[model samples]
Target chain A: MSPPVAPLGWSRWLVPPAALSVHLSIGQAYAWSVFKPSLESALDLSGTQSALPFQLGIVMLGLSAAFGGTLVERNGPRWAMTVALICFSSGFLLSALGAATEQYWLIVFGYGFVGGIGLGIGYISPVSTLIKWFPDRPGMATGIAIMGFGGGALIASPWSAQMLESFGSDNTGIAQAFLVHGLTYAVFMSLGVLLVRVPRPAKTAADGGPAPLEGVQVSANSAIRTPQFWCLWVVLCMNVTAGIGILEKAAPMITDFFADTSTPVSASAAAGFVALLSAANMLGRIGWSSTSDLIGRKNIYRVYLGVGALMYALIAWVGDSSKPLFICCALVILSFYGGGFATIPAYLKDLFGTYQVGAIHGRLLTAWSTAGVLGPLIVNWIADRQEEAGKSGESLYGLSLIIMIGLLVIGFVANELVRPVHARHHIPAQKEAVDVHERQQPA
Target chain B: MSTSDSSPPDSSPSGRRGLITFAWLWVGAPLAYGLYELVRKATQLFTG
Candidate 1:
């Protein structure tokens, strides 16, 4: 149960790569959409049936992260990363077996359940550590690592698509792809397990060394009891709901919108659209979060939620009449979405301090899980109902777009309501003083 | 808690530079590959 350490004389900068290894590997969760069509056709499954594994995986990701936050905090990043590696890779291995045997439930249980645990644990493993390492730039440091999660899908989408193409797209091909993904990611994530290290205990500030407690510290247990936490919870959930609503249906929505135009979007063009969104997502994670370090977390989220709502309104108003406008709106909304994710850890740190920021972050991700369900359900259900009523093109999505705009407005209000945690929520100075005294007592 | 607590300095200058270089390569390689794929996809949008 000792904290992790780098080899003799290693620099703190090396830690980000360790975080990236785990995030890039588990971030494959974002690319699950790439497998949906292949799995549906191969297994004789309906769209809903095919979506089960992905939907459930997101649910498990939030749930596990919420519950496992403490264990990760207790155990250190090496243990958390190792556990993530085993579960995530094994989830893929089990999914391969499921695909080979044609048991769809196995895929759901394996990828959705086991693999998702890996996602949750792997995600939070780096946050508290990164904040501690770059106390000077918590936003930027976490941004660098979390941006990998956004980029993960960018790598996996084309890679998985190519793998399916070469391997033949049959049951066996899917299994082979799954197996390769599992093995490769396992090896890749191992670098994180090997390299990540917690800083050695801080020396006194008088010695010109790292000192703990740079700001007011709120323990994780106390953070949840405050109104600020729940307000942020709403803000995150609504922002994600708005962005994911579009993301889950990006390709089809574009085609449906532009189909009647002279320049109808081809399927390949639609895929390129998805990649463009990923690029924006990745770039915004780093770009906006770093900007938050300067502008402050609260001000940046005003842009994410408030301006994001405006983008949605513009899309709804302009409809599909201008393709460039449509794409531009979508890209900006998605950048805010990614920015929202990247910035929240620092937001929590700003309010709660680095003491249990990781655990607080884990609790906050329940918002993502909730949004994962709500976002797609709102978009797809409305679109499906609209289509049954004979609506086509932009009409199919217009209402859904409006609904998303409303959600973003609600998120904007929540963000506006967020205030600093009250003094009652902060850890009593006496308790902290006693702990420091006890630690310094000769062991 | 007050605002004056400073982050620990890196153990050494060369070691810090080496670690930064190592980190860039390790994380940067995969990211660059993803960017390449996205570029390829983007080109298809116009090329077609």
Candidate 2:
């Protein structure tokens, strides 16, 4: 059956908001840190125990997206958005129930597993559709949508914090917060599911131009066979690891870094720092990525991986010497982190063609899952050991920063390793000629 | 694959430019504020 087409007017404007609903809801994962202290104190859980929901959520986000990419492509954005809305909202509901009943595993299952599915599906749903709609400006289009994901935390963090404060940061408060998130997001995300529609087939091809560079197309199945894919995997893993290492500990790290300085970071100031980092993360998604379209993907990545390494080194070497320098370097690093996420889809488009770029991109997110764990593990483990050794403040994070620098350097090398695939791997001109001849001869 | 027979729309260049300008303005401010926050935080990291 032919899909119904709506008259074009304001519908295009509806797309990004639909994308935002899903992104903003799952993007709450970033604010999980705000609840960590409460979870620890109330549940009498260890840091590692409290981190499980977040860790599992990330893991599921990557895994489900990777596995569900083909399904998303086949089912279309509306279907994908619907699934994301249901799972994501349900995850919140489950987590709320778990919190009220004091079932940690339920929180993990609900928010981590189910919501992660929502994250994975919601993330890829609009990506390809947006790319199709704005072929003239794929980077900017994708950046605009993905930026919502990063910025979602900015809104959620403060709001969740307020809710916790009002409801009481006790277990009951956390439960209420979870309940509110589930109920509110269900309504918010439904707008996307209801409003989203796939572009008409003829319009889809028209939006880009004829002869959409099919020769360079690589299916997600074939994409994994190439060494370029693995190299990018390493590059993404390292970049995320470096950035998240600091991000996961933004509040404490900032306070510790400035503790010895004349103008020590106050509690409120430290919270503001975390908010600022979130903002930088959100902005970098759009700003640096739009910049990437001009400079080319590889060159922008050189900035992300190479300059990122330098930022980490400066942080480690200086050890909180000048607060201005530390903050400046970290901000640049986080911007790159945000840019890395935004620019990668365009990069995939450049290499793989748009055939199944969304799916390919989804599969690549496994690198994020790996870094999610690796970054925290390396940083927190080092910090814990340092604390045991009587180290405090900036000293505890120095080794972690050093490790992050090493990872970034490795990522830099991997970025350097990226080159255009050889012509042999490309679809042959003869095959294309035959296909064209067949089409010309009539079905 | 080469379907160029359709005539282009007759919108004035000024109109197209206006649309582009509008798009940038619409999406630009919030994006800039987000970046400002990053810069502000980075400044704090350095000075504080």
Candidate 3:
């Protein structure tokens, strides 16, 4: 006989811990910059060269999540969480080994290739589960899970910095830090795996009535065929690219922008700026996205794409003339960046229905992978070339900011393209009616 | 379509009572903490 399923009660509550376990562990990705100074000093690498691991890790995160989405749906959350635990923890172990041996390629392979897979899988594991549990509040449910992803960095940034400080900030220290990360995360993530339980179908139906379906229904297979899917893909790609351009180089970019101005960014102040941006990114995931439920999905994207472009323009034009302006524009831009991630699930729910939104969401993450590479490359590459041409400080990043503006404009157009799917694609009403009528009027 | 015409009433709430308890222990606290953290983080951003 098959094992007894736990009748669904409050499995919804379990979703957050599962989300935090994955997000907090993967959030270590953001803390990589703390180790950059040590790596450069010990390995004698250039800035761009040192950034390779982080860039590759992000690239892999998008790819693995996109490709593994369908498999996750079929095998269930337990399997996905297990794979994430193994890959993410092992990535850290391998990075520790690489650091100890002074092997850069190993670091790339372990942290970027292996760990990135963990990041992607872990990121999506709780999202669909949370949505299923809280059908009454899809946006709020998703926001709760995604908010962990944003805050993961807040906890990790300070913790990693403290570890590096204690461990000597040298190659040896870095390796030891990596070992601690591997061991501790393995323990932390295991709690989530143990606690996670899939809610039974009967229980899910009991928790909420048919009201969960709202006004639309679209199967996962049909969802991919619609123009709405492609429009959302464009929207996500543009939003991520705009935000990550600044995030990938938060420290250097801020310092560069203010170097020639009257108020030079001190080392501590630069670190504070990164912390502040991270805080904004985390907050926006919950705040702006929760607000989207009240304000409608389309209206919210208008703010993200429309206001986002204006923020970029202000930064590019004004330079560093006003510190308050610079901070305000960056905060708003980061908020939109974060809102893009938090809101996309609801956007999927809006257009495709919740049938297999997890799988559809998995497929959509390819846009994130594409933007992950494009955003950083456009900004860093342009800035590098400009620096070589004798540009310095704020002037170094001006061209990259212009490119971000162009991308946001395209995203705005894509958001405008979104509309409800045609009724022809919905599940056949006659078939649904027959199923219900058969149960109502006995054989 | 009448209010009294839906599916039969649940007879297994007792069987799943343990699970309801488990859900609170496992899921509720962590989910609540995560939200609290988000609010705390946001306040830091706006205020700082």
Candidate 4:
């Protein structure tokens, strides 16, 4: 079915809110840590057991997005959003029921399997719509919407904690919290469904009108075949892996680094560091990605990967001695991490075209999944080995930091290799594809 | 592909502004609340 174009008098500006509504709600995935302690205690589970839901949720998010991408493209944003709302909210409700009954398995099935699908679908749902609405500034448009996902945890962490506190951290209380989350998100996401509008299709080039793509347009299928896609894939994976080294260990690493200092870092201060990182992540999504509109996407990645490697090296060299320097490095790195995510859609649009950018983006998210695993494993495992070897303080992270620098350098190289999709890979300019394209452009 | 739709309805400048405002407030209110919560949590580092 043709996507729902904005009605007459509908301002294209309104579309971002619709995208944000869904994004902000699904971004709650990042806050699952808030419920971990409660689940472990109430369900009498081990740390690893309690973590199953969150880990599986992430795995499913990648899997579902990779698979559901084309289905989303075929059906349009409305259908995608509705599916996301149902699965995501229902995942919460089911988990609520599971919590009430103390069935850990049920909670896993509900949250990990069902809720994860919601996360994936909701994540990609707005991308194409936002790109269409802001064709002039695709990076800034997707940045605004994806930034919500970065900030989702900032909203959800405290909200979930307060709910657990007020309702009692027991089983029923957890259930109540889940219920509230499900219901509230359902209502909130409905607004996006109601408010979002696709652009009216453009007139054909034959009619002396602008085409949707200003340059070479590659279909998702053809785009995937090009070496350019794989190069970008490596670029994204390496960048995320390097950044996750710091993010996954922000609290513990900070405390460990400053333990021998005259003024030791406290637990509360470490928490603040995490909060600051979130702020950096959110701001970078909007700020750096918007900057990419001027600087060019390829140049922005150079900053993220190249300068980011330099920042990691600095952290390794002077991190423990200067708290201010450490904080600055971490914030800049996190911002680059967020910027990396926000810019990729526009990058894909540049290389692949808007026609299947969402689907292509979905496939690309698998790189994120890989980096998610690679980053944490490298950082945490090395840190663990260091601790076993009787290392302490800043020494604990020294090697891991070095490794991150190397990974970032690799990412920088991969980025430098990216070139425009070759003519051989461009989708043949069929009349139907052009028709679909014209229908999507704004008047 | 063919262009089949009629001309778009003309929107007054004020109407466009009002709609943009509506969209902003709709998304902005929640984001502002989120930021408020973050600031409150962040204060713990200094206070604690």
Candidate 5:
């Protein structure tokens, strides 16, 4: 079906909330940690096994978004949001059944395979619509939605903890919690489905999206063939890997860095540090991305990559000596990580135009899937080897930090390599007219 | 994808303003709640 176009006088301000409804709901996937302990104990599974559902969910999130992005663009945000609501909620309900029956694979299939599709679809669903509605401020528009993704965990972490507390941390409790999550998100995400609207292309594109150069549109197919896309793919992957290196190991890394120092990070303080990282991650999604509107996407990425690399170097140079310095570096690194995500859609709009930008963004998220595994693996592997070598304190992370710095340097070079797409990549004007005709018609 | 619920119709100036308020609040309230909880947890870093 063709997406619902905005009514003649619909406020552009309304679009961000619609996008937020879906993003905030899917952001709950980050809170899988909240269920990990209970799943490990109640399901009688290994730590690796307990991680299966979440790991698979991340993997499938990338796969589905990559494959399903075109469908989202063709079908519109309303269709994509509805699909997300169904898949995400049902994944939860199915996991509830799995927990109740003591069948682990069911939970993985439900949450990872099925619900993961929801995460992916839900993620890129609004990009095209928001960019269409707020071409003047695509960075800020997308920042609000992506920020909701990081912030989703803040809400779900506490809410899920409370639910597990009330329901007890046993198998029955896990099942009930999953069920409630499924039902609750279904209801909440329905708001996005109801509220989202595509711009009426002929009219509203001029109304909301009237940049003189915007008419030069690139197809999703054409976008991938450009060197610009691959450069960004590497840029996103390296930036995310750097952030995840610290994020996945936040609590432990904090405590370890300061273990032999004057001021040790106690377990409680380490927990607090993780909370601070989340704050930076959430705020940077909106803050730095919005700032990109002022500074330009390329310059903003210089901060994320060049300055981000400097932050890693500072950590390496300082070692375990300074507590406050360590926290400051890590927080800035994470803000850039989140900013990279939030600013990317606008970056794509700048390079590709709004035509199929959502699909292109979807394709770009494969970098995230790769980084999700690559980030944790690089950090954990290096840390493990360092520990085996009798390294103590920040020494365990010494090699990992250097490798992260190398990755950031590579990413910084990639950022510098990005230039505007060649005119050959833009969709031929004659063909674009035909595609626009097909787009306006219901399929 | 079709749903019974539609954007709150904007027939007049006040009606449109009400919608802008309602729309922002729909998402903003929960986000504020999340931020509040996050701030509460983060304070332990300084305090503890």
Candidate 6:
């Protein structure tokens, strides 16, 4: 189960594809919404009941990443990828059986519980490896891996829709669809398992091979104890929450904002709007995070949070006055959201060094899980209350926008508060050597 | 960021270069297809 090590003069470029295979496959999580309507109609389920699988899947994503991060580091990417393939693919297979048997609980347990573990593990598997491979461009390397996650849905959304169209959206068809998905993804993700390689330790500590970085070699356990880690936690949570605000209700929000306008948006255009946001989300992961390599992580996050708050304000103050203006602002905000996710592993690499970055990154994902729930709850609950009070059009969303702005502002402050880790957190060189050796051997 | 271990230098052999090309194409082809489909869908915003 040990990871494959790169031979002398291995091309670092190969690493991103390995990482992308896993990321893109797990990214199918985002496309789950595409299946929601079909499931509801077929099973006579409520909207909320149909939503159970996706919500549980996200919750599991965070928990598994947090708990399994250290295990991933110890076992290496090969072992991690193999595990992800089994759990994730089996999740679909289980759902196939559930759909065939008409047992919704089985679908939830399979796709949400088992599949989500794959999402978490696959998400972080390539992060530290990419950081190690491209130490000089850590942000860009990690960006390439994470961008696949954002783009995964773009591929899956249409592909799944087409499959449902062909196979029929009824129980038997749904079973066939799930079966195909499981087999296809398992085959696709295998390339990553075959190709992943860890770098050979550098001849010198400065060369950034499995060595202590910037003289700060904090373990993941010690990292969680640092003020720096908590600050990033708040920062990531706030950023994700803010981005998810628009993302969660994008179609509805856009529709409501323009419902009373001279030119209200149609349903088709709203779907297009969602697709546009996905494009922006995927592009931002690569574009802005790569820019972080040039401009620095701190400065780029300042843009994500500080400028992000301003974008919310723009949307609020302008109301539904101009469609183009609203879209541009939302697009920028969503881009910042993607940039935040892509840049964080590099930020962890910066603050704690690479010794336990993947593990630390795993722990930090608890913030994403939190934001995933919090962002939608705050937006939806407030919108529901406003609607009850006879609010309509842009008025229903005004308060939600204000709350989003506040969250971004808090994130901005958290990003600013981040500083270098204290010396006490740095592992001594001898102990660091021993820990690295332990990491290399199979557990 | 202060770091080391660069990914690809200008110097490379043909065999390794071909493999790199293959690896990137393997991922890039799907990503590009997805992007094209997304862009096609997003065009509805203006067209509709």
Best by DockQ: 1
In candidate 6, which residue ranges exceed 4 Å CA deviation?
A204-214, A441-443, B1-12
TM-score of chain B taken alone, every candidate? 0.69, 0.67, 0.51, 0.71, 0.67, 0.71
Model 4 bad stretches (over 4 Å): A205-213, A432-443, B1-13, B16-19, B46-48
For residues A1-443, could you state the per-residue lDDT of candidate 1 as single tens digits? Answer: 54565445667778889999999888889889789999999999999899888778788889889999977876778888999999999999999999999998999999999998999999999998898777778888999889999888878888999999999888999999999999999999988988888755544546533345556889889999998899999999998999999888999999999998888898888878877887888888999999999999989998998899889899889887899899999999999889899999999999998777888999999999889889999999999999999999999999998898889888888888998899988886556534433332334
Question: How high is each candidate's TM-score?
Answer: 0.91, 0.82, 0.80, 0.94, 0.94, 0.95
lDDT of all predictions: 0.85, 0.76, 0.76, 0.86, 0.88, 0.89
Error of 5 at A66 (Å): 0.5
Scoring only the A-chain of each prediction against the true A-chain gives TM-scores of 0.92, 0.87, 0.85, 0.96, 0.96, 0.97
Which 10-residue window of candidate 6 chain A scores lowest in summed lDDT?
A202-211
- Candidate 5's residue-wise lDDT over A30-142, tens digit each? 99989999999998888889888888888888988998999998888999999999999999999999999989899999998899999999999999888877777889999
Q: Please identify model 1 stretches exceeding 4 Å from their true place.
A: A6-9, A37-43, A205-212, A430-443, B1-7, B10-12, B15-19
Q: What C-alpha lDDT, on a 0 to 100 scale, does residue A1 get in candidate 1?
A: 55
Model 6 residue A287 distance off true place after TM-score fit, in angstroms: 0.7
- Residue B17 of model 6: what lDDT? 87
The Cα error of candidate 5 at residue A229, in Å, is: 0.5
Residue-level lDDT of model 4, residues B1-48, one tens digit each, is 344442243342666787678767877887887898877766766665
- lDDT by residue for model 2 over A238-347, one digit each (tens)? 99998898888888888887787787887666766776777778789889888877888899999999998898888888877787788878888998898888888888
Using TM-score, give the best candidate's number.
Answer: 6
RMSD of each predicted structure:
3.1, 5.4, 6.0, 2.8, 4.1, 2.6
Residue pair clashes in candidate 1: none
Model 5 steric clash total: 0
Q: Give DockQ per model, in order.
A: 0.42, 0.14, 0.12, 0.40, 0.26, 0.40
Error of 4 at A283 (Å): 0.4
Q: If you assessed candidate 5 against the hidden native complex, which CAPRI class would it receive?
A: acceptable
